[model samples]
Target: MNKSVLDASALLAYLNEEPGAEAVEKSLAAGSAIGTVNWAEVLSKAMEAGIAPETLAAELEKRGILGNTLDVLPLTIEDSMEIARLRPLTRP
Candidate 1:
């Protein structure tokens, strides 16, 4: 709750109008964040659902839901380093 790092999935859910879209909308209004990486994930899902990228981007921009507008954070060194370290584990 303190970090607000848990809403990207909800954001995607909201875009898809899934079960928790309302909560995601509420979270967005209350100041939640979306990671840059998660933006790709959201876009990917939107594409898979037949949403055109340009249109989707516009929708997100209009809603002021683009990561930068709401709080799009880049990976910190520690996070990237850990992901690098975990790459070997991912191989298997």
Candidate 2:
């Protein structure tokens, strides 16, 4: 199975039940991962939304999202380089 690498936007969509959330959920169900940087983005967004980081994490854990559904991946040097390479294409 091809594991999906979820960005902060994707995970945020799923968490907030926003548009495209189903797609994100599908990715999660089929084995997806978020890099540490993206995970931090999610946490930052949560804090901005007035949701305590621990509270949000606990809620995710209760729903079996943290471990069962989504995996957090640490970035390696190669991964950083790849992201940097893709940055230009991803940005206008």
Candidate 3:
């Protein structure tokens, strides 16, 4: 089974139909997930684009974005801690 841990950029590409969207779409079709924080990032970007978060969320849900193609998963404690630990490795 093809799978991937999608981040905000990948999701945004798919949503915006940008280049490389097909790769994201493929992962989505095979089922995929995003960290809750990444999920928030996607929603935040949508909101910045004038979409009401609730409205977009509702539509996505209605369209089965959740439970079908993508799963918005809560970050586990280990995941959060790892992110914190890796913070210093990332650019500011």
Candidate 4:
């Protein structure tokens, strides 16, 4: 199975029963999971929308999702430096 990297938008669609929810579900059924950064973003959005953190956590656990199992790629020091360097450049 090809692994898919789901960004925050995709996860939000799944959680909110949006149009692409089915696709997201299908991906998960095929063994595709989310990265930690995306997971955190999804949880943050859910919390902002009034979904209790514990409830979300329990639901994810019930769905056989494990945070530690995600292929969370870490940001290297150079990557961090680049982001910092580019922040001012992209500022409006």
- Give the alpha carbon lDDT tens digit for every residue of 1-92 in model 4: 43776777986898789989898777666666565667788788878989986888778777675453334455668867896999999888
The number of the candidate with the highest lDDT is: 2
List TM-score per model, in order. 0.67, 0.87, 0.81, 0.65
Deviating ranges (above 4 Å) for candidate 2: 89-92
Q: Write the per-residue lDDT of candidate 1 for residues 1-92, one digit (tens) a residue.
A: 22456445777778768898897777666666666788678778778989977788888778776544456667788988997999999786
Alpha-carbon shift of residue 75 in model 3 (angstroms): 0.9
Each model's backbone clash number: 0, 0, 0, 0
Quantify all predictions' global Cα lDDT against the true fold: 0.71, 0.89, 0.86, 0.71
Ranking by lDDT: 2, 3, 4, 1
Over 1-92, each residue of candidate 2 has an lDDT whose tens digit, in order, gives 33798999999999999999999989888888888999999999999999999998899889887877788889999988997999999887
Q: Write model 3 residue lDDT over 22-55, tens digit each, in one string.
A: 9988888888989889989988999999998888
Error of 1 at 72 (Å): 2.2
Model 3, CA-based lDDT: 0.86
Candidate 2 pairs with clashing backbones? none
